[model samples]
Each structure stands twice: as C-alpha cells, then as structure tokens.
Target: MTDWAAHEGRCLIHLLPDVITLFHEYVQRNPSDPESGGILLGTVHGPHNQVVHATPPFPTDRRTRCSFDRGSEGHTEVADQFWRESSGIIRYIGEWHTHPEDYPSPSGIDLREWKISAAKRTDGRPVIGLIVGRKAIYIQSTSATGKALVYQALLGNCPALGH
Candidate 1:
C-alpha cells in the first residue's frame, strides 16, 4: 500500500497493494509491448480516496508503444457494475496508463485530457491521472475548478519505484 498526498494534505489517494500489483504487471518492459491502461475504480471517503480496482485493457483499446487510448466498451459497464454492487460507493475516479520510461512524467496530451475530464465532472470531485513507468509512477489530480496538483508518495521506499 502507498499513500499519495496533494493540496497541502487536503486530498489523499491511497493505492492498495492489489492495485499496485495490477499496474506493475503492465510496466512496458518489453520493446514490443505496447502501452496498456484502463480506468481506475475506487471509493471516496471524505477527503481521502482508496483505489481498490483497475479495469484491464480490452481488445477495443488502442495501444501503441508510446500511447494508450482507452476504448469505450467494457469500461463503463464495469464501472457501473461496481457502483451498483458497492451501493454507489465505488466509482470512476481516474485513468492510468503505462509508460516506457523509468521515471515517467505526464505528456502534454495527458495533461490536456485530464483537464478536459476534470471540467466534465459534475460531482465536483477531482480527476486523477496516473502513469506507471518501469521504475516509478506519476500521479496528478485536477479539481472541478481546473486546479491541478501533483501528488508525492509518502513512502519513498517502494521497491518497484526504486526508491
């Protein structure tokens, strides 16, 4: 498990070990492996959030060495199902993709997409953007008002992150 904090500790994202393992499974380690990603599903608790599940890439998703475009099919249905099963507790919180670099950073396209997503949210909750790299993960949060912030991991000792 890892805790990521942003906005002067006003917001926190707790990534469960399972979620981390799921992401690590697609780290883009092979030269022929394309980028893979999916939707982030989690539960919100006041100012804190716990990421419990991540949808896997589907056949319809567009995957390239440097980019991943999530397909519409299978993604929404999974989110809906989780929402119903959890009594509206679990929801679509964010998106995540794998990067080839060891220390990944958000690209211009990524930032733009996140901003657009945040603008479309009607619940006033933040939208998260996650990039899993070969050795580290990058996370960003955008508020309903378009305020963006980067989160830092509380534990600087994760083996996968090479900390």
Candidate 2:
C-alpha cells in the first residue's frame, strides 16, 4: 500500500497494492507508446479513502504520445459491475493517466477536468487526479468544497507504507 495525506492532514488516501500495480503496468515505457489511463474505483470512509481497483485502458479511449482521453465504453461498465458487487461500497473516486515524462505533474487540462469532476459529485467527496510518469506518480485531490491536496511517490520495489 502507498499512503498520502491531504494538505491539512484531515484526509488520507491509500492506494492499495493492486491499484499501484495497475498504474505501474501502464507506464509510457516506450517513446512511441501513447499515454494510457482509466478511472479509479475505491471506497471512502470519513477521512480515509482506499483505492482498491482501477480500470485498464480500453480500445475506445483516445491516446497520443502526450495525452489520454478516457472513453465511455468499458469504464462505466466496469464501475457499475464493481458497484453492484461491492453493494455500493466501491465507486468512481477519481481518474489516472500516464505521462511520458519521468516526473509527471498535472497539466492545465488536467486541473480543469478535475474541477469538472468535483462539481459533478453530489456527495461532496473529493475527486482524485493521478498522473503516472515513467519514474513517479502524482496524486491530487480536490474536495467538494474546492480545497485541494497533492502528493507524489517514486516507484521502485513498491514498498508498502502506512499502518
């Protein structure tokens, strides 16, 4: 597991082992490989949010050397399936995509997309934006109230962290 705390320390985001693997598997390793990404599925409880699942890139998604546009085809179906299986405990908590750079950061398009996602949430929970680079992963969360928190982790042997 990998852990990150909100800016104020009021919230914590846990990306489980499986989710981390998924992110790592899609790294833009090859110079020609376009970016890839999918929606994050997880469970939220108070200030602790656990990311348990992540959808893989679908053929429907649009990909370029520097950008990824998640299509609707398989993402929603997977989210729905997980929601039903988990009795609504699992859900779409955020989005993640790959960047060709070694250390990735959110682009202007990413921030705008996150803002739109946060606004669509009726439950007021935060929306997560993750960018997986060749050597690191960036995580940012925007609360329903418009507050934001961010973190980044370097990848190696996938060391587990937190209690």
Candidate 3:
C-alpha cells in the first residue's frame, strides 16, 4: 500500500457535511435556472492539490433585473451571509453548484471562474469547486504552488488529485 504519510508534502481536506447538505438542497430546489454557487473553506498545506466538496448554506441573491448582470447574486449573497452570520468559520476556499442530472465535473466556464477566483486567493490557498449532482469535485491549485490541476474522486476521501 502507498504510504500517504510518506509523501514529500501532504494536503489535507475535510468535507463539511452541513455545507454539502445545503448545497444538495439548493441544487434540488433550483436545478435549471442560473444553476447555483457557494464558497469553499479549508486549510492549506505544502504545494499539494486537494479538493473538498462542501455544501453552501447561504441563500441565492436573485435581486437586480438583468440575468447577466445579476451574477451569482442571491446564491453568492447567501454565502456571504453565512460567513457574516456565522459564529466563526473560515472564508470560502472556493465555490460549487449542481449540474442537474450531470456529473460534478468542472467545465470551461468553471475553469474561467477558477482562474479569476484563484487569482483573488493568491496566498497559495487553492479553490475547491464541486459539481454536486454527479457527486464530483475539482481542485484548482495556484501556479505559485508548483502544482498542476488536480482532480480527485469525491465519492470517498481519496485525495490523489490527479491532473
């Protein structure tokens, strides 16, 4: 067996169930329109790639008239509210949403979002994105960490994070 502890550097991840439940419920409630979105919170370690499938308990922001201009609106606002209203939880390590009857894999648009979000979290902290329906998640590592795009199987806690 491979000794996970023997690795040069290890990245640790913990899936927040409360968060995941919220995400699942959000997707189930809004499967088609605007999809959904939320924040990821976690700890970072050495230049390792780790993916965490977290649920967002925040509500979606449906304000504003324009769909394009609205952005993640209510959903993102919900995330912010959770952060603002919480007793004490780390800020979103990344974001996630549902993919209808599809797998939880990252898409081109998802990548673009990661690029922007990762740039914002330039402190070597990776952004974890989850495509909930198919029960999948993606880990987008920062360039400065000397790591490549890592994909892990979220059905269980296997943190291979392969490119």
The lDDT of each candidate is 0.87, 0.83, 0.46
Q: Estimate the Cα RMSD of every predicted model relative to the unseen true structure.
A: 1.8, 3.8, 7.2
For model 3, how does the per-residue alpha-carbon lDDT over 1-163 read when each residue is reduced to its tens digit? 1111212334444554455455545443333445555555543445332223343433343322111112444545544665566543435566666554434556677667666666676464656555555343444443333333554433444322111
TM-score preference between candidates 1 and 2, better one: 1
- List the candidates' TM-scores in order: 0.93, 0.89, 0.56
List, residue by residue over 12-127, the lDDT tens digit for candidate 2: 78888898878777888888989999999999988678899989999999999988999869999999999999999999999999899887888989988898899898887779
Model 3, CA-based lDDT: 0.46
Off by over 4 Å in 1: 156-163
Clashes of each: 0, 0, 11
Give per-residue CA lDDT, model 1, range 1-163, as digits (tens). Answer: 7889877888889998888988878888889989999989998998788889998899899999999998879889999999999999999999999888999999999988888888887787879999998998898987766678898887673437433
Which residue runs of candidate 2 sit more than 4 Å off their true CA positions? Answer: 144-146, 152-163
Question: How close to the true structure is residue 37 of candidate 2, measured as C-alpha lDDT?
Answer: 95
After the best TM-score superposition of candidate 3, give how far the Cα of residue 161 lies from its true spot, in angstroms: 21
Mark the regions of model 3 whose C-alpha exceeds 4 Å error after superposition: 1-9, 28-34, 45-89, 134-148, 154-163
**Model 1 clashes, total count:** 0
